[model samples]
Target: MVAEADVSGKEAAALIFTYGTLKRNFSNHPLLQDLILNGDASFIGTYRTVQNYPLVCGPYRVPFLLNIPGSGQSVHGELYSVSTDGLSRMDELEGTSRGHYERLPIKVVPSGEEMEAKITCAEAYYAHGSYAMEMWKKNGKQGLKCYTENETIGYVKRKDRPQHLTFLDHIRLFLSD
Candidate 1:
């Protein structure tokens, strides 16, 4: 059987849920805009996860959808349909290989239509499994109903952060900030 990550739109586009920076007008939206302009992705609509999930910010104010199921709020986000190449690019951007994030299945329904709408399972990027729990602890165990960090203290892009520091080092810098 083909691995889930390898299964893509040879025939059908994959559904994706964006809970943080990838949402419209958020920090990382330019990438999605490029995908849309190139016809690699299409916006489905505003959607929210069916179950509660912790949404927190780590170093550089990066939003993390913690993998701890049923622990936070029914987070709202955007949904999209992406072609194979689109999925691949998103996976790369999310750093699945580097363990920055992991793509996992999540159930979402149209925003404001929860009980009346059909639930759809889409793939969403979450905090890396190895550090998710620890990250939550570092964030004072706080959970936001939505990801709106860009308006206050903003996210620093990975490229802009110090190139040589380990993630733990960055975490230290973040705490000091």
Candidate 2:
């Protein structure tokens, strides 16, 4: 079961649990750095998700958390406290309206030695469809291999692929076809 944190005044900043691109030094980090109160935030819980989902690299070569049941491996990521505006910006970037992802509240545990006693309820951007997995499979096994080998880097730019496909567009097409 998920534990609930005291989210009263002065501690109500929305918590965000990120397991992919939004992590430090990744491509999307710049968008969140200013909004993150703790750059050194702790991991939410164990690296596994409640339901299996593929964590694959999309056509953009960026790592995407696919919401495919029974298809993911144990994954690691960070947690941050973001203001309301920050959440909006993050939603925009994740294409929440366009169905690239869905922002949902999740239960998280503080991994910091000093804060281990607290459990946080946070929101996370989870991949909403199978496009990411399809794109990853189409790219061959190389992308998956690289991601597994190096968990520190969340996004990878593929010089060979054109930037014509936006992440949202890819998902839309996949769902329609």
For each candidate, give its TM-score against the true structure. 0.86, 0.61
Name the top lDDT candidate.
1
Worst 10 residues of 2 by lDDT: 1-10
Error of 1 at 157 (Å): 2.0
Q: Rate the local accuracy (lDDT) of all candidates.
A: 0.81, 0.55
- Model 1 steric clash pairs: none
Error of 2 at 123 (Å): 2.5
Q: Which prediction has the highest TM-score against the true structure?
A: 1
Segments in model 1 whose C-alpha atoms lie over 4 Å from true places: 1-11, 149-152, 166-177
lDDT of 1 by residue, 11-81 (tens): 23578999888998887899999988877777889999999899988887888899888888888999888
Give the Å error, residue 19, model 2: 1.7
Which pairs in model 2 have colliding backbones?
A: none
lDDT of 2 at 101: 81
